[model samples]
Target chain A: MTDDVAVLGAGLHPWGKWGRGFVAYGTAAARAALLDAGVGWREVGSIVGAATVRGGYPGHVAGATFAKALGWQGARAASVYAACASGAQAINTARAQILAGIADVVLVVGADSAPRGFFRPADGDRPDDPDWLRFRVLGATNPTYFGLYARRRMAVHGDTADDFARVKVKNAAVGALNPNARYRKRLTVEEVEASAVVADPLRLLDICATSDGGAAVVLSSMEFARRHGAAAPVRIRSVSTVTPRFPNTVLDLPDIATDSAVAVEPSGETFRSSIARTAYEEAGIGPDDLSLAEVYDLSTALELQWYEDLGLCAEGEAAKLLRAGATTLGGRIPVNVSGGLSSFGEAVPAQAIAQVCELTWQLRGDAGDRQVAGARVGITANQGLFGHGSAVIAVR
Target chain B: MPRVLTPVVSGWFAGDGDDFHLVGTRCSACGSVFFPREDVFCRNPGCEGGDLTETPLSGTGRIWSYTDTRYQPPSPYVTSPELPWRPYALVAVELEAERIVVLGQAVPGVTVADLAVGMEMRVVPGVLHEDAHTTWTTWHWRPTGVAG
Candidate 1:
């Protein structure tokens, strides 16, 4: 494993549907991070931004956009866009800069003022664009894909709707304790059952909503952290950013068809499983090493899928682990102590960073109500559109 | 009323009855086959450029998975706003020869209740929608014993 970089600070602008520009949220988050790090804006040697397409031309140049918003101190700037994986990618960018000796203290930020409702494609029909084609041809909204997966699990693994609801129930309880979560109210399986169906077999409560939010992290080399008076800090051990191997047949989001496997025998592991496996190998840790986990729960069923993919449990045993309370607080490996996307909704760029923020808090023993006691290591897993893998392993 | 004959993607399938076949391109190098046709560069990272020859896909495949879309899909998928929504079954069929899974709407009158894992089905052309002038065509999965 590469030497870890200390997380000097973490900040967030509580997730919600606020009508403000992404820059505003990102700048606010950056300022909060600076204050948390006990450093002035000028002390930041670099700025890495996770870009949002919602911001028009400025978003394409996100590092510069956030840098300008925070008042440019002539800091080195970089911007990255990897769909939902943008935040982790931004973190990866900053980590590289620090490791390369390009920067002593780097600021990484991801914020978005998400649009309302089912995320529609950029207007107008272009059959060539897969995102639009799926909508036009199948009316396959994001939830539709979620629904498909939920049903597939049900058919193949015998997972029931109640099992899906338990995920929301577990996550919402943790969210209730998280001041930064969009939904603080605890949920019940009955409530999930009563909720309207957004997609068949996936209720409204089962899916994450769109929201506006921001998250930022202050990362620095270990020497810089100690010199700056942080005797001990949460260190990021590994950041996995992998691409899918050919012949992926899972029919992922915004795609019309799976890759033809006729040419190549498919890999033994699915893309998601491969993502976590890479991180495990890079960090020299196994699934049993995890103290807690924060996985992208775009839908409740997807969270269980992560349990298997992360190797927290064997295949088709995610629901069993959940029911056995192994994944809840005080269990073998608590998950989503930050409420997950099921509670936070999805601000795309901000969510993954928020996962890291939760990891930082739990590892530091500062997680108030949802604390995973004596937490030493945590992993945040997320997947991006097209084929992008994102997972970060953090240890105290 | 008129039945529209079309493939959502052109040249994916042709002919009728027992002679029906699903067409895909086979890469001369690395022997990788692509459905929906890859006209430009070959996607296999390991292979150099190769001629993509059109080959007929296997006529039958087993169902990998199935689900029904209970809600109406959003735009580009044409449907009359005045009419009530009708849910349709979608199936992922695994073709053994292509070693790939292709998804399509189940033929009319088929529902999720009628499908099971590993059930055999064949690709059939179906009409998506129609206006006074143009009819949108797409592929549908029909059980072999079913009569249209």
Candidate 2:
């Protein structure tokens, strides 16, 4: 296993449609993280910000913006944008700095103020851009893709719409306990079924909404953590940012077509499966060793997809595992104990970092009612636009 | 005024009726094909490089998956504000020979109920939107047995 960086602090700005600028939420979360870490902003050697495209210039150069907002201490700054995986990429950047001895302590932050309704491509008549082409030509929104996946699962795995609702039901039960979650009300299967259909086979409640929120984490080298008296802090074990192999068969977000597999034979492993496998391989652990998981439940059915992709269960058995209550809290390998995107909606850049924040809290035995009992090893799995694959493993 | 007809993005597809086909680029060295037509280079990692030639994609393929948009899409996807929103089906078709999945709107009147995974589908030309002076033409996927 690679050398670990200590997660000294984790914090968040509660998710919702607050309609405020992303900087405010990010700064608040950064201050909270710094307070939790007991580290002064001046003490941080570097800062990495997960960028938000909608935030304009400041959001694009988020690292500098956050650094300036936190009172410029001349800390080294960097910004990264990987769509939904932005947070994980920022965390990975911080970890890299720590491991490389470039920074003793690094502050990682991600936040977004999302637009209402379906996410659309930036304005303009740029036919060269695939994101624009898909929307302009086919009008296929995000939920359309989710519906496609949900329907595919139904046809291939015998999964029903009821099974999809059960996932939302399971997550809502736990999400109600998370103070940071935007949607706290527990939902029933009937409510899910009654919700308006945004796309066929997937209702509005089955899909995650776009929201404003922020998350931040403080990381330090093991030596720095020891020096700061955080001798046994929750540690980040692995951060997998692997890209898809050639001939990616699955149609991912913002793409109009899958890679042609005519020349190269399809890799037996799918992209999502490879995401977790790489994390497991790097962390020197397996799914069996995971005490809990936080997967990007973009849609309730997609959560089940992650369950199988994470190797928590055999192929075509995710729904069976969900039905058996193996993925709920107090079940075998509990997934999304943080309420997931179903509860938090999506703050784009902040979501993945928030996943890690959940892991840190759980591993530290500080997650309150949502805690997975005896949680020791936690993994977060998320995929972003284009070919970005994100997964992080944390252990106490 | 008489409206002109044009492909939304030219060079993606051509021809008429049963003779119509989507255009893509095939790598001479690796035999890999790219949709939306990759003109610059081959995407295969194994092969050093190859000449990408314009090739017509298969006229028929099986539906990999299907869904429909229930709500109106945002800007860039033009919809008449005066008319009530109408949902349309979308299908991702898997070409057997090239082994690629291409997505497009289903022919009007087809909905999610009529589609199933692995059902045979074929591409055909259709109108995407219309302005005072122009009609935007694009591709649509239809069940092979269905009449246009």
Candidate 3:
């Protein structure tokens, strides 16, 4: 197993359509995290910021923006963008710095004020960009892809809409307990069925909404943590930032096509599964070792997909596991105990970091009413557009 | 004069009716194929790399999956705010020979009810949007045996 980096603190700005700038949310989250860690901003040796688009050029330079907001003390900074996985990339960047001895303590931050309704590519005729081409040529949006996957699961695994609704019902109930969540009301299968169809076979309730939110974490070397008088802090064991192998067969988002598999056979593992696999391998643990998981539930049905991809169960058996209540609070391997993106919607750059925050809470027995009993190891799985894949494993 | 026929994004597809097909590039050494056509380099990592040649992909394939847009897409997709938005089915078709799944909008009136997984589909030209001086053209997927 890779050596662990101490998770000194984790925090978030409550998610919702707050109509604020990303800088405001990010600074709030960073300040909260710093307060929780009992560390002064001036003491931080480095910082990494997950980038968000649509805020002009400063959005791309997130690290500097947050540093300036926190009253920069010459902390080394870096900014990264990997679409949805941007938060995880930021965390990975901070963890790398801590492990590499470049910095004793590094602050990782991700925040976004998402645009309302369907997210579109930046204007201007850029034919070389695939994200632009998909919309310009086919009018395909993100929900459409979620719809296709939801339907395919129905055809392949007999996962009815009822099964999809159960995921929302379960997550919303949990989300209701977390103050950081946007939507807290319990939903019923009937309510899900009655919701308007945003994409074929998937209702509006099944899809996640866009919101303004931010999350941050403080990472430090094990020695630094001990010196700071915090003994047995939650430790991050693995951060999988992997890319898909060539000849990716399954069609993914922001692409008008899948890679042609003519030249080579497709890899056995889908990109999502490979993401979790790398984390499990690096942590020297397996699915059975996980006490809880926080996954990107972009849609309720997508949560079920992550189940099989994370190897919590065999392929096509996620629905069966869900029916058995094996992934709920008291089940064999409770998943998405944080209400997931279903409750939080999406704040783009902030999400993956938010997942780590959930893991920190659960592992430390600080998740309150939603906390898993005696929680230990936890994993978070998420994917970004254009082949960006991420997962993080934490244990205490 | 139809304001001069134009492919919305040029060189991605060409021709008319039965003669139409999507364009791509094939690597000479590894025989790897790229859709939306890769003119620069072969994407296969194992290969030492080879010349990418422009090639026409087969027009027919089976439906890998399908969904319909129930709401108007945001900008860059070009739906008029003035018109009541009509949802269109989007199909991912898997070409057996090329083994690539290409996504496209199903022809008008082709809803999710009319499409099924594994059903046959063929590529055809369709209008994306139009203006006083021009009609933006794009490819659409239609079930192989269906006709208006």
Candidate 4:
């Protein structure tokens, strides 16, 4: 017997700069999920929240706060904080609860109200924090990290600015059909090239913006699904939330240095590669089996990097893969069918769950216009600021 | 009078000129090295935890990658609003002996146009910013052949 939990419902609050509280977005998404699942609020035995650092007290006590917003019926609540991977962690927690028989049905919620401009660390003079030190010392914004990765890809793989622009063009075209996407207009490759550089080698269009948004999912045990009068429900096959192996040689975000590989040899797989590998192992599948993928394309070049890390292409061959039209909508294994972060921007806690929500819709044959034709298996990949690794594999 | 110097984060670097080095912690038992200096214990899981000793990282390393900020980064990274934001290059250098990557701002006057991947760059003393009395000193990376 396969260990599977059903994604009974998926819902979202449209992503954009909606000057409002995260609670409103989260509550609306939660209610929509509950309604779509045909499950009553009182029936939900558990709620797992992906927290936003903003929004005062409610943001801090996310799970309980959402429970209260939904007229609390005494649901067991938990909150997760894993930077960008918070949504996946929340979903994983709910899945664990279902698998353990602790709760037959659980609600997972993620929402964020991102501030304008570059995302900054909390106000402080704490030199102990690496996130703070990165800004204070290097003046490195998120785009600079993307720029470094983009430039490196160019040097090693011979990727060009034209290649980077194609990623944005493709994602933007697909995003035009996504109603929940913050940016619905199609982006031309030339337009992307014409945009001012936010970081050298990476233009403003090459990077995703910060946004306000929310996503919610109603997950239940396979047995609970059948009893609730649903058949052929989309199932979550795997959730990988792992830390980096020691001597993580790749320079990741918010860090000034990579682990020293001099002492011990670095693992063959970089941290990102390991994330997808772990999820594939748990799901008993490979990149060949994926009908679609939703990766954290914080930058167009980074999206190409994910292609290699997720095993869709060999290292230094990402640009070639793009040129072949293999990663587009009608390709053998399409990536970011939901338009990705290139469209929705980053809602931090919400984006990962939003990926799953897209997967759920596509699998159900309900993703109109942007549907991945005959999709059966989907995967999402994202990395948290620190060492947190996240990926999820879903299938029908 | 010589400008008073203060390191943005103390113990991260030391010395005035050619004697300079980035300070990291070396695991006495496993020989693992940590930058941004982890003093608690070795990060390597296989080796038994050992006392972390302060160690100097290699002065020169190959540029793993490099980039520059074209816009002013949001604060805590103090930059004056009145002044036109001058961009600075950032480099991730893969140290030779330590086999670790350390990121630092490229030395003043160095731009993204001047650097290439795998070029040798060495640690040097530089000023991050100056306000009234104190000059916030920070480490910088310069191409090996370039003079500070």
Best by DockQ: 4
In model 3 chain A, the worst 10-residue window by lDDT is A132-141
Contacts from the true interface found in each model, as a fraction, amount to: 0.53, 0.89, 0.89, 0.92
DockQ of each: 0.55, 0.90, 0.87, 0.91
Give the CAPRI rating of model 1.
medium
Residue B57 miss distance in model 4 (angstroms): 1.2
For residue A162, give model 2's deviation from the true position in Å. 0.5
Q: Name the best candidate (by TM-score).
A: 2
Candidate 4 CAPRI-style tier: high
Query: Which regions of candidate 2 fall more than 4 Å away from where they truly are?
Result: none
lDDT of 3 by residue, B53-135 (tens): 99899989999889999998876888778999899999999999999999999999889999988999999999888988888
Candidate 3 vs. truth: CA RMSD? 1.0
Q: lDDT tens string, model 1, B1-148? A: 5645555556767767667677778898878888766777789877897998888878789887777777676676777999998888877788887888777788878987788778899887777787775677777889876876
Reference-based lDDT, residue A175, model 4: 93
**Chain B TM-score for candidate 4:** 0.96
- Give the TM-score of chain A, superposed on the true chain A, for all candidates in the order listed: 0.99, 0.99, 0.99, 0.99
Q: Report the lDDT tens digits of candidate 2 across residue range B1-148.
A: 7899899999999998888889999999989999989999788889888899999999899998999999999988999999999999999999999999999999999998899999999999899999899999999999988888
Worst 10 residues of 4 chain B by lDDT: B1-10
* TM-score per candidate, chains pooled: 0.95, 0.99, 0.99, 0.99
Q: Against the true structure, what is model 2's DockQ? A: 0.90
| Per-residue lDDT of model 4, residues A1-396, tens digit only | 239899999999999999998998999999989998999999999999999888777887789989999997999999999999999999999999999999999999999999999999899798998899999999888889999899998988899999999999989989998999999999888899999998889999999999999999999999999999989999999999999998898899999999999879987889999999999999999999999999999999999999999999899888889888888988878888788999999999999999999999999999999888999999999999998899999999
lDDT of 2 by residue, A26-74 (tens): 9999999999899999999999999999999999999999999999999
